[model samples]
Target: MARFNGTMVALHSPRMNGRGKLMFSRAVLLCLFLVLSSLPVADADAEQQSSEKALREHYDLQEGKRLYGEYCRFCHGEQGKGHAFNVTPPPADLTSPAVQRKSDIELAQTIHEGERGTAMGSWKWALSKEEKQYVLLYIRWLAQSR
Candidate 1:
């Protein structure tokens, strides 16, 4: 936003009479108020963004836990390790160094497309990107809490 340059405005104006001076002071006050009022808007926007990010993360953690229970527990087990059910292979231990070493993108991709020739099935048809991330974050939190 363009700032009000009072000096430039004043220079362009004719010499002020007592009444004009009063009007000029009022205009300057208005300009200052406008500038100052706008300053807090920037702060408010940043604060709002921070709050939204935190809220989303909180929701992801909660939803991820829920989703893990509903979809993953049958195989991955409650602790993200192998479950008792017999499949050709078992679910990956999410906390294992090998799995944890995968990049976030790689993890996301695996979640999206599942492991080929394994019990893991592609969730791409069922989960959104954000949903996948939530599960990923929950998986991370699992490792972290462990």
Candidate 2:
């Protein structure tokens, strides 16, 4: 038997003493402390990642609105009702069912490759892929706002 912190502890081996028991208890406590301390850090990391994603999405939408104002508003009009400029055949009313019915892929293609025989020109040389996507997002928002 060995006395550790005024408590009796039975030992089967002669090599084991109060000091060894104390060291083992300390080691266990250290391991528990390390594990518990890491939990909050992991939770904080997940929260930060979620927050970053939300902020990125919000900024992307804002950029989309800005792009629409700069590029599409002249032809599509302020509200996408079209014909802001006096172009022949007039630009398509973006909020109309005919235009909104088109899939995102089709809309993106038109933005990238231009509609033939119309005033709409290809933006492929002018805008990056991400910018095109942002424009598409703005178009969708325009439809929904109607």
Candidate 3:
């Protein structure tokens, strides 16, 4: 039977060695490693979720920026800091504690349903569910950075 010597996986399958043992062929092991790498890293600790969120979002956060510009920049301004308008009260300060304190569901609802008594418009039609998630993650990243 092929054996793992604690250094490297044996390249030969046990089937070839005629020992009747199930072996992890190098190709199978490589494929498993690659597949696992693409998936989200699971963690048991809640604190790790925040950092994992950043890592996952970092991959597509730039696309999130594009979504932001397409859906948010006009009113919320660059980075959702509300600098694009000189209007009274201005748009929502995305980085503010009040805004940042919102849960993901609240944020998504705000974006999808728009706020009452304001110029903000619902983006439910403009962005898909996944797109909304990306936007939210990007907004969170922006808030965290500042």
Candidate 4:
């Protein structure tokens, strides 16, 4: 990628004529397109691999709910609202679009890893991967319904 300009520039001298320059320009553009387009395919492939890994390692949705109830319900509330706690800056409203705006990885990390120096404990050690997915699913479901 770094050397792409050098490669294209090198093509200029040998292709000085109008048609040669046009062909060279097309080739350069094609090369750039191929390089750029290849990135998305690689990214897509990585996403698929990660998703497959998650599915193979953690696909049980119910278990996630159960774990959420045991670990999160007290803080997040039965309905996933911020009402469960009486402490400062009450738990987040899982049903809120604000909360829902966060990405899955963010939610998963917050749940699995837990917030530091607060009531949120690391469920990463306590719950299985499947349970985490269920919790996330329940959170998403609650958010949508709200």
Candidate 5:
């Protein structure tokens, strides 16, 4: 029997054993399995969110903006839409999906080693590794803001 909202309801199972106990243990086990299986997925999502938050805290967006202004703005423009200069093939639009889809390491490498056949020169000699990361963070912010 089960009580719900001040009402008692009889719980019956036609497939009960001789002891008068419901033979629905498999159903209970299945429900338990489903619930337990979902726990790891929830934990993974929470972990991902926390890691992203940590990354955000680790980087300074203000410094990134400053670096962008000093080094990247001449080509990428104030909004990072690119094509600010009249160069052939033009600079990559930092806010575009194609650029945004690139991994941080790839973008960082590009910043460290300038692309061939383009006006984008290497910043390896100019900015430190940390500064390059800051610039990457600013690029991500640009994509989001757009």
Candidate 6:
């Protein structure tokens, strides 16, 4: 007899039948089969969810590029390869994987909140929360294109 959670699994094969517990053994096998057979549905659901998330993210990235052109191109250039700046670190060469490796949250924070004491001025006053997210998606798109 094996117990899992609060249920006991009693198995009785022919060898165990000599012990007069063959019925219990059969019951346990049936229970195990029922439990195992029901698990694949959850796995299918998880795969479906993963696919949906990828599709949504892809669409958001497309929207992000539009937002970036409107709000960021003046300083970052049309390609985001950096343009204006006297000696300031040129706006990021956003196409680089090194720059894109940052998570979406990190990118959004940097764009919306800005890195202080540097020429990277905050856009919090200029863009809304959703706009910042779109910018992040645009940066991601640029990096992937490279």
lDDT of candidates 1 onward, in order? 0.85, 0.90, 0.81, 0.80, 0.91, 0.77
TM-score on alpha carbons, each prediction: 0.62, 0.65, 0.60, 0.54, 0.61, 0.54
Compared with the true structure, the alpha-carbon lDDT of candidate 4 equals 0.80
Query: For model 1, how does the per-residue alpha-carbon lDDT over 1-146 read when each residue is reduced to its tens digit?
Result: 23375442332245657888788788989999999999999999999999999998898899999988877778888888766457877778888989999999999999899899898889998988888888999999988887
When 3 and 5 are scored with lDDT, the better candidate is 5
- List the pairs of residues colliding in candidate 4: 64-131
Over 4 Å off, model 5: 1-59
Model 1, stretches more than 4 Å misplaced?
A: 1-53
Give lDDT tens digits, candidate 4, residues 14-114. 43888888887899899999999999999999999999987854545556667778888998898899798897657788898888999998988988888
Error of 3 at 58 (Å): 2.4
User: What does candidate 5's lDDT look like per residue over 1-146, in tens digits?
Assistant: 88989899666666667565534666677899999999999999999999998877555898899999999999999999986888987999999999999999999999999999999999999999999999999999999987
Error (Å) of candidate 5 at residue 45 is 22
lDDT tens digits, residues 74-93, model 6? Answer: 77777777765443766777
Predicted structure 6, TM vs. truth: 0.54
Clashes of each: 0, 0, 0, 1, 0, 2
The candidate, 2 or 4, that scores higher on TM-score is: 2
lDDT of 3 by residue, 42-88 (tens): 54455598778877767678878889988898888886898787766
Ranked by lDDT, the better of candidates 4 and 5 is 5
> Candidate 5: which pairs clash?
none
On lDDT, the stronger of 1 and 4 is: 1
lDDT of 2 by residue, 1-146 (tens): 78999999865456868888888778879999999999999999999999999898889989998988988999999889996988887899999999999999999999999999899999999888999999898888888988
- Score residue 146 of candidate 3 by CA lDDT: 78
